[model samples]
Target: MKHALVFVASPDDKPAYREALLMLGRVALSRKLPPPDVLSGWESAQWIYDSVDGELRQEAAAAVAELPVDWALTPVAGRKKKLLVADMDSTIINVECLDELADFAGIKAEIAAITERAMRGDLEFEPALRERVAKLKGLATEALQKTYDERVRLNPGAATLVKTMAANGARCVLVSGGFTFFTERVAEAAGFHASRANTLLEDATALTGLVQEPILGRAAKLDALRSEARALGVSEQDALAIGDGANDLDMIKAAGFGIAYHAKPLVAAEADAKIDHMSLEAALFFQGYRRGEFVS
Candidate 1:
């Protein structure tokens, strides 16, 4: 079967050496991919290889860690998906927004512990989220805006991934278990076509310690994926989903190409593809796109 191996270096820590690509070319049944068609170079590359068999591709991908880069292995056909459904916290953004909110409430360690457990699948998502939010009850409403301004920054290559995908006519949606307040900002900044998230209820000037009912958890994420795919006149297999925590598992598993991006251990173990050492643009390479083709 025809396969492709995408190699990605850490965006900020890219090695200064040159032999990494040379060594990669020595693998049997593989040919070097040309330099990025739209740019002078790229931090990641793809090799459209004629694998001797199915397992050979897996074996090659597994062994790529020995090199100075991270990698993903996927089939050559339908590599570029038509839709992108992604998680916001710890996936599109560098910090978990709720945890940052916890910091403003002076309960950082306590709330972050629950967040860690919830993300690792050690705790039920709904209950954990409630517990965390409850602790922030009575906190000033402006804290949300403050957290967004001071702490919420996009993860490396996040914009490049969303914009490039959108430019290729793919629809991008930010479906997060976080909140609408942050998702609205992130989706706009990242250039996603739509956004959906739970709403954090607020009183006159403070949080009400409650989220609107029917909280958007794991199941909701899956629903959003299906609904978006249907609206786009595509099957679930035509979509790509990426996330970094337990709440994202269902949709991640349901998509044609699901990736765990710098994910928790449980997610990484179950996702179709895992990106542990690269930026969001690695997802683009996984879809057979070159850096030059990126919109921004």
Candidate 2:
């Protein structure tokens, strides 16, 4: 099978780092393939090769284990996907909305603990979300806007990733277990085509301390990916999904290319690729995007 091993460096890193990575990659592949195709000067590159032994990912990892570069080794056929389904909290955005809301409720530490455990796959995601939101019972509805205005910020390269993909004819959707209050704003802010998330039930003045039934958790996220792909007239293999939590596992595993963005252990273990040392722009590099072609 034909595969492309892509390496990405932090945009802020010195050019020499990627140079060293290219040299290391050349040695690792040992002239089996032509020199890498540079996607961004001293920032990203890809080596296309034929590997029939089926140990491609391991070989690629071993080749750059000592370096600071982040990488993805995937089949080259569907390198550029037609649909992008991304998780909001801690993936597209810098902080977990639920945890930040917990801060306003004066129960941040406690709520954040459940969040950590749930994301790590130590607890069920749906119940965990409910438990966390329940703790915010009676909190003013105004806290939602406060959290959005004061705490939420896009992770580095988030906008570029979404915009570039959308510009190239892909449908980008932000799906989260977090409330729609944040997902709606985040989707618009990040240039996503649409958004889907749980609704936080509230009265005229405050939270009802209860989320709507049939929470959008693991299964729902996967459903979103499938439904969106269907609506786009594409196969599941024509999609890319990314996230950093256990709730994202189903969709991540189901997408043609699934990436774990600074994820918990379980999620990282199952994802097709992971971004640890670089920004979300690494996703574009993995998809063979050139820096010159990026929208932002």
Candidate 3:
């Protein structure tokens, strides 16, 4: 029997899902869909939310090889895809928290320069974080909430992605190159199971303008991936890691599937899959989902 990616999605997202399905279908049409239950080179079939009989899928693809057709089906939610890890800054929200904070401090130009370097893998992540955080020492801690209220917006499809993934017995982990203040907030807002990030200095109620010593750098992100995967009892292949910067590379590499979400050039090129010019919903495609079994 042959093995192929079974792409399924939900009806709510059907328009995009349908588009993705037809794309996969085109591939199946090309090779006449490999014979299922018979392992061979060009063997794969794209199916909607059906208990895809390997043999059946191959038959269908080969049966319709000359003509491409759209398979309309909806996903059955809570089917369970576990262990989703995401980066908080640009991936979860529309902007990087530190960059916004820096802008608030009137040092936007300087901090943005450093951020670009860090995101592109040019400069080390920790040092860049430290330098940026140090510039905000005098801002009131209350500014954090105000910023959240003003600009800490979640990305499109973020709520649906996290909620659906979590409902499927998946353990969600938020790992970021940013600080804990922001990571923690994101974790709570998004219903993530756990989160890890560097700590920032807050003396009582005011910003200390510094990250804690021994910052959680790139290696730390990797550790979070491994630990969460182990805890979730899923092999590395079942893991889904998402991020958008250089610091997230190691962690992304450590997971079964690494996604570069609107990332810097370096990260987008290095990740297992790239979510370019698209929302997090694009990540669902790499999972090879169809609309029949994954939507609630």
What TM-score would each prediction reach against the true structure?
Answer: 0.91, 0.96, 0.76
Task: Please tell me which model should have the higher TM-score, number 2 or number 3.
Answer: 2
Q: Residue by residue across 172-243, what tens digits does model 2's lDDT show?
A: 999999889999999999999999999999999999889998999999999999999999899999999999
lDDT of each: 0.84, 0.89, 0.67
| Model 2 spans with C-alpha error above 4 angstroms | 15-23, 27-31
Q: For each predicted model, how many residue pairs clash, with residues at least 3 apart or on different chains?
A: 1, 0, 20
- Alpha-carbon RMSD, each predicted model: 2.7, 1.5, 7.7
TM-score rank order: 2, 1, 3
Question: What are the runs in model 3 whose C-alpha is more than 4 Å off?
Answer: 1-26, 34-81, 288-296
Give per-residue CA lDDT, model 3, range 270-293, as digits (tens): 676565544565455435443333
lDDT of 1 by residue, 212-272 (tens): 9889999999999999999999999999999999999999999999999989989988888
What global local distance difference test value does model 2 have? Answer: 0.89
> Top lDDT: which candidate number?
2
Candidate 1 matches the true fold with a TM-score of 0.91
TM-score of 2: 0.96
Could you tell me which residue pairs clash in candidate 2? none
